[model samples]
Target chain A: MSEGFGLRSLHPSVLLLYYAGGITFGMLLFHPVLLLSGWAACLIVNGHLDGGREWRSWSLPMLGAFVALILVNPLISHRGRTVLYYMGDIPITLESVVYGATMASSLLGLLTLFVSYRILMTEHKFLFLFARFSPKAALLAMMAAGMVPRLRRRLKELMLVQKTRGIAVSEGTVTQRARNGARLVGALLSWSLEDALQTADSMQARGYGTGTRSSYPAFRFGPRDAWTAGGLFAAAGIAFTLWANGHGYLTIYPRLESFSLSKGDVGALAAYLVFLLMPLGWEWRDRTTWRSLNFGK
Target chain B: MNLLRRKINPKLLVIPIAIIYLVLAYVSLTRGNALLIGIVLVLLSMIPFVWRFERRQRQARELVLIAVMAAVATVSRIPFAALLPNFTPVTFIVILSGVVFGAEAGWMVGAVTGLVSNFFLGQGPWTPWQMFAWGMAGFTAGLFAHRNPSRRRRLPLLLFGAAWGYLYGWILNVTVALDVGVREQTWSSVLAVYSLGLPFETVHAAANVFFLVVFAPSWIKLLERYRRKYGALQRTDSGSADMEGSAHGQRTAAE
Candidate 1:
């Protein structure tokens, strides 16, 4: 119902910085332990951020997915040295289970980060930040993103219309449901064709793909953004340098090895924490402002 | 402008265009050597259909129709592998585009459907084949843009829809074979791979036929109702005049 985050409020610079940081984090610090920790932190933060009903609804599904991943993944990937038991041809292994958990946690972490980012950024800001480099592509991307909610609304309306016409979509058997689905698809396509034509006309009229465009600069790099970017770059550079100079890359195959955390690793992790905290700082600032408003009481 | 002169309707182009696409797709599948050439021809053919359609109609309305159809088709494909095993809703969506928006709308819908759907599915050389196949199906459906009940002749239309599904699968197989550099590109190899896809193809055909039967009548009725209510259906000459006036208004406002 809330339709997630409003991208309009955040500075484009912050969004870019955050996005860049996420990519770097994914590529560089992709260890099982670090990934799990980050994922746990993200879930805790997101759960707090998403207020009551939404979190309540999501919790069960999240737990189900987590359990399914942990249980099923180990059964398929039984290639570790530490074999726990053998169920016929299938060899259960402690290493494989741990490795699976790591992979699942990493996926969950990445998903959480993406969901948070989606909530925080608006399409206009997203386009504005990226458009200077590629206006046509960026505009298309923005339109594509904006179109999702519109289509969802249209689908709901179509569903209601179908229902009123005594098209018992829910009450049907499997074959009947499939038939109903086919009919719904047809109706949706019909409406979509008309909508697409109108949208294209409007876009074309406004000089879309005309090779000329204008911009309004709404995002600027404040001190917080600058510090975050600088910290992330320095951390990434040092990590790359160390890895290039023979620092061990963590391997999750065959067996799990605890890589000794070097000085560089420690520094990189600290910087990563700072990068993560940037959003928290903004939240704190907002909370402080709210508290200050109640000073008279 | 005379308000009663009969003009060559672009809506009639859908049937022949669909036939051409089906032929190309069928030929390409049965013979692998012509795969590249067939794709290029099909894509190139779309330009003329689109150009002619734009010239004759309110381009804005048509463009919107294309965008909406394309977007819906793309969105529908996203949840297919994610949600259902034998899902092929985009095929039905393309058909719906043709039935509702007319022939040109169907063409645009097909083109955009192929292009946009590839983003979620991943893009490759096969993208062009997909675009052409889906686009043709929609375009062809638009050709039979009449409101008569006898037009509801189900069997032939069902067969036509089923053939389009196979045609799409066949072209896609050719693209895959070519990409993988299968040196022989023989009938056996194509048959072996496409045979495996028989279930999917069957589902695709069944879905399209099911959709066509259920919603086609009601959609035609709705279109007729709209035309009668708004007096949008015009005598041929008057239609052109209205189209031109609308186009002129759009051009000025855009400038």
Candidate 2:
């Protein structure tokens, strides 16, 4: 509905395919080197999309999670043979430590990809894609999503008015605060339900359930999308086949293998990165076109 | 879209589901791909609920009732967002939705609460997991409420809420544990994930007990009145959100 650029201009299915493939490949490829490279590519793509502001906003929690995984894995699982140190009779293995770091990198890469995902896959695109597959459930999620802002405003109003009646959640003991919070929500619930049923009557008057619902125009599956989807599938197919043959995962247990990429791993890594960053080409193309049309680059 | 309107024979549905699980079983067993398998299973588990809801001929009031309940569940978190991390009336609201509207409506509310809340926040591996977990919490709440006669009873409802507080947390924690990419997962490694989540789950369980103690009676009464006045989700027990969930639950379990 709004003007979009680069990845946002892609069809919703293609966008969905990109994320699904990105996450799947990120999870499947377990080499720390590959994961680190994946993280770099992910961040660069994130920067290309929105200058990485969204990625920056989510950095703290993701970093905390990253560190937690790095610390927790070595402590809990004692499988790896290369024990780096001992903590109270618990042997900290270098293998588990490396495994944890790789996991953390995969996670960081996932969070970065999701930041781009949130930017490109706007709500309208999500609803449009899901609506075909599961109509009522899609409608349910969409309508509920639509109602959140209005309900939020009403809840704020209720909370403000209820503060005058010596009722507020912010300034109470544990039990007291919980009660006041639910009280505000209860009031909000009653108020919203009243208006909601009226809206339902309007929906009924418009013959909502009378026939199969016609939809608004969805984005066309253009030639650009076709080529992108074709390339994505081809690259991913190569990567997945190699991964299935055991090139993607690192050998962590029963003594760790060297992190050097074999020929198969290199091939898999190449295909995977191509699949991961193919959409970046769209951004370069879009930027050059925009610059030629509007201003000097 | 039209496919959902046509009656989907469960026996017919089983063929595709069985094939999917078979393929997934091969992948997970051979490749040790826990993360992808876990995510796929979570996504598949939600289909029956969505399928059940789609096939039913719903009244506008019922649809609106579910949308409003889900919105309320999503927004109910705002009041306490500053007070604690992961503390909110969302679970209670979802449970109440199940208790008042019946299990199917409760499940829809819970699942939609998961979907809508994450859409408002952001999507991650947890989106489908939250949907399944929250949906189960609400499903069980409705199942218990429906089987039992007394609607406003406190002790049973409080225990139910308390159990799901931890159960909900653990359901979400499973994804994280598997997502950690353990090559060969032993029992202790799984235990470590649970141990990591213990504090948050404890607070969550305590919060559920507190909310149930404080607001069950008044909130249930408030919604009960609306269900009667608007005649929303109050048709014969066969076709509405309430009774359909038990049947659906049995089918999902069987699968």
Candidate 3:
């Protein structure tokens, strides 16, 4: 869906493994370099996904969240010994601020990665992931995913109709407004419930849950998927090795430790970055090659 | 006290686990490792309890109903956000779902709403916590609602909704703060986070109270009617006999 990582084109199985591994790494690792690399990778993928339009909108909010964390963390946490000045009786320790910054970066990193996931993991992908495990739950998730957007659209229409009738949400006092909102919801509830009953009937008619349900397979494993998966595992293995060995590790508890890079640190960081950027790398290669072939004399 | 009942009230273990975790979280606020572990434990502790419901309700209709409730809860936030800005109808709908559908359905609705809505809000580390917080809200509300189904009163439901507002906020605050890291163990730091969140909590609680006060009766009646007419599964034996009467009751209400 993006110029960066058309991750959706990859087989859902590959995408799933990539995301599960990526998110796990993003969540577990707290190294500043790794976090920053992950965050930057997410932003770039997200930027490409939206064709460079919506990523800016997210940047400001993400920055705001990070800034808010920076301000709040030091105030609540006072563990570090280095006093960086005090606001009233509170000692805003250097370590806590640094820790907060790390957290903010990690948070930002995790959030952006999820944004990429939103782009990469469509409802079909989500359903595909769950379908093998529990067909009923998969069906439910699919219906629920479809229903959210449909219901939201319906609510907007209802609100518009209500507004035309002078019983709109904004036109009343606090209680009146809430009543108006609830009434709208109540109406939707009855309608949707009736609609759902029909669905249940239709599903029963189609013999749902009668036996092992067969799903329409929209994906197949191919050589490209296998190669990409291999690369992902190899990179991830190397990175995990470095991480487990304490390379590129920076501790912020008790006292702030040094973040100086050694040779092994650089290797670990590179391995980690490679693991994170595998999808982006594929997409970039594809785009550049396609562009050159088309424009070449 | 027999530790295990045939019909396990998950709240028995879940509630105590949460309280113990919260206490641990409070005590270890300054220690990053303990705080992190406490937060993860708090999020995970509710799973075994909620898992019981998932296994209990394996029927397609029940599954569809819970999904529908979750979808409705997710979408209901839009109008409220548009109109009230700070207020959300999500918790109200979630609580109502629990009250009408009983604990399992309520728990499912709550957890699913958190996940489905995060598709719009953008998922983060906070998602599991949201799922846990909302799931518990539905669990307890359903518990209360199940205990006294015949009396669908206003005050108690309203009070429960209001209480959940603050409780949800506190849980959410702790989750986010822990995610963000609260480096000191001091009560003041924890209090500061709570105080900063006071206005939002008040708004959330007020919104819950307001929604329940206004629409809970009608929604409950509507869902009850549907359950009766469609022969939706029930979680309690006490209400089993009332089904036939309510089926006709739904027909008349529709008419």
* DockQ of candidate model 2: 0.50
Candidate 3 docking category? acceptable
Report how far off residue B134 is in candidate 2 (Å).
Answer: 0.9
lDDT per residue for candidate 3 within B1-255, as digits (tens), equals: 123322564335546646654553443343343324544575666556444543443555676787888898888776676565559888988888778767656777888888778877776667777888888898787777754655458998888998999999888777554544344546666677788888888998999988888778878888888777666564421223345366446534654
Candidate number with greatest DockQ:
2
Candidate 2: tens digits of C-alpha lDDT, residues A1-297: 223577778888788889878987887787888888888888888888878888888999999999998998888777778889899899999888987788788888888888888888888998887887777788888889999999999999998999999899889796677778888988889999999888999999999999988888668777788889999999988998897787877887778898889999999889988987898898889889988989865
lDDT of 1 by residue, B9-105 (tens): 4245545755654563454334322333445455556656544543443423333434555676666643233334555567766765565555555
> Which stretches of candidate 1 lie above 4 Å from their native place?
A1-10, A44-48, A51-57, A137-166, A195-211, A221-224, A242-249, A259-265, A289-297, B1-63, B74-255
- TM-score of every model? 0.56, 0.91, 0.84
Question: Which regions of candidate 3 deviate over 4 angstroms?
Answer: A1-6, A47-51, B1-60, B150-152, B179-183, B186-188, B235-255
lDDT of 1 at A250: 52
* lDDT for residue A81 in candidate 1, whole number 0-100: 83
Total clashing pairs for each candidate: 13, 0, 4
Worst 10 residues of 2 chain A by lDDT: A1-10
